[model samples]
Target: MSSTTRRRFQHPAALIGAAVLAASITACGSSDTTSATSPATSAPAPASASAAAGVLTVRDPWVKAADKGMTAAFATIVNDGDTDVTITGVSTDVSRAEIHEMAMADGKMTMRQKQGGVVVAARSQVALEPGGDHLMLMDLTRPVRAGDQLDVTLTFADGRTQTFTTVAKPFTGAQESYAPGHGASPAS
Candidate 1:
């Protein structure tokens, strides 16, 4: 083969190899980064709020701030033991906390304050969703941002009380789930 011809073939071959090497390096870097950060970026599982030694496990707790300085939080409560638990009362920095429900009435959503409070069956779970049953943080002193947490106290029907902090999130039009005895009980 002529020297010039050999030179042309070598240059093109080297260019192609460099291109392949660059593509491979980019692909490897992206995969490593995604794998390294995937777990941390994924949603958190759940956290628990304990009673006077009472355990209340909470999942995906989310709160929506209202323009009138009120906010609502919805979540699932799990009783991880044999004994049933009751959440009778709630308190927050906002105006008094209460169990409230958003229901459809006359083609409009209406909010009703609940007085019966919530009960988690023994070894069972209760979900507090939007539109049906949820927590009302009245007269919020501060805005509940996406990454913020709200500290609340929950009282039981047996006069046993438990306080815990809950993470706040924006509501996504989820219907609130209802359980018997789930509402804001009369404050003592």
Candidate 2:
């Protein structure tokens, strides 16, 4: 073969090999960077208020703030045991706290005490939220504000009680209305 022809083939082959090596290096570098930074870049899960019992767990317990009148507390009760559990009552440091239900009565929305307590089925969960079944806090000794914390206690059917610390957050979302002032008559 002519020397010139051999030179042409060698040059092309070397160039091709170099190109392939460069591409492979770039890909490896990018993959390493992604893997190294994944944990730092990814966000952590939002913290939730929780209390644990032998057979029960409560999550995301929170209270709505009221100037000086009435507000509500919500939580999720998870029953992990094989037997059902009934949440008989709720008590808070405020003046009064009770388990209340919002329902349509006589073609009007009425809020009243829930009879027989709230039952969490075995291996299931019950969520107490606004406009549904929740704990009503009335006659507050003082005003509640955002970022404040309160201690609430729950009474179970089996004579077991669990106390949870809940954070107070100002919520302006609409809820089931009471007859007159919706029980939030904003301090006289």
Candidate 3:
């Protein structure tokens, strides 16, 4: 081919290649940063409260690894606003999620749904830990193994939602009994 013809083809090819590279970078570029010791924080959501409400964030979010049955997620939900924040519901594509509490019922500790959702007071935080309060993932759509990452969405009472990514790790604690009709037993 002549030099002019070659230049025309090469210019378009270079442009296409650059565009693909840029697209790849954009797809993989996520704001979430996590480490073995550090917690993964969610992006700041708009302050539903006054300007002093600041922002809401989830810290050190993680999930339990399980092949099937049920597992739970642990995190510290921080609310920096002047008004209280209530997480009414939790959701994930991998399973049916619910905010659960382990409380004494009939002389025994049993796991059941939280009655009034989870309330994080103004300028305070709520810790969702094992054997206390947690986000329960039931009937997993697929097996969750160690080192896997999952996206969890928290719906606030004000109709605002914040989605965060959490990594799965092996956890053997919180062996509380499940209430009847909840679902299959928790993974041992």
Clashes of each: 12, 0, 2
Runs off by more than 4 Å, candidate 2: 1-55, 175-180, 183-188
- Candidate 1, 85-181: lDDT as tens digits: 8787877765567887665557766667765788889888887766567777766666666556676777888887666566654443443322323
lDDT of 1: 0.60
Q: How well does each candidate superpose onto the true structure, as a TM-score?
A: 0.59, 0.67, 0.66
Every candidate's lDDT: 0.60, 0.67, 0.71
Query: Lowest lDDT 10-mer window, candidate 2?
Result: 37-46
**Pairs in steric clash, model 3:** 53-81, 53-82
lDDT of 1 at 91: 79
How much is 1 displaced in model 3, in angstroms?
Answer: 36
Per TM-score, the best of the predicted structures is 2
lDDT at 160, model 1 = 71
| lDDT of model 3, residue 126 | 93
User: How many times do residue backbones clash in model 1?
Assistant: 12
Q: Candidate 3 local accuracy as lDDT?
A: 0.71
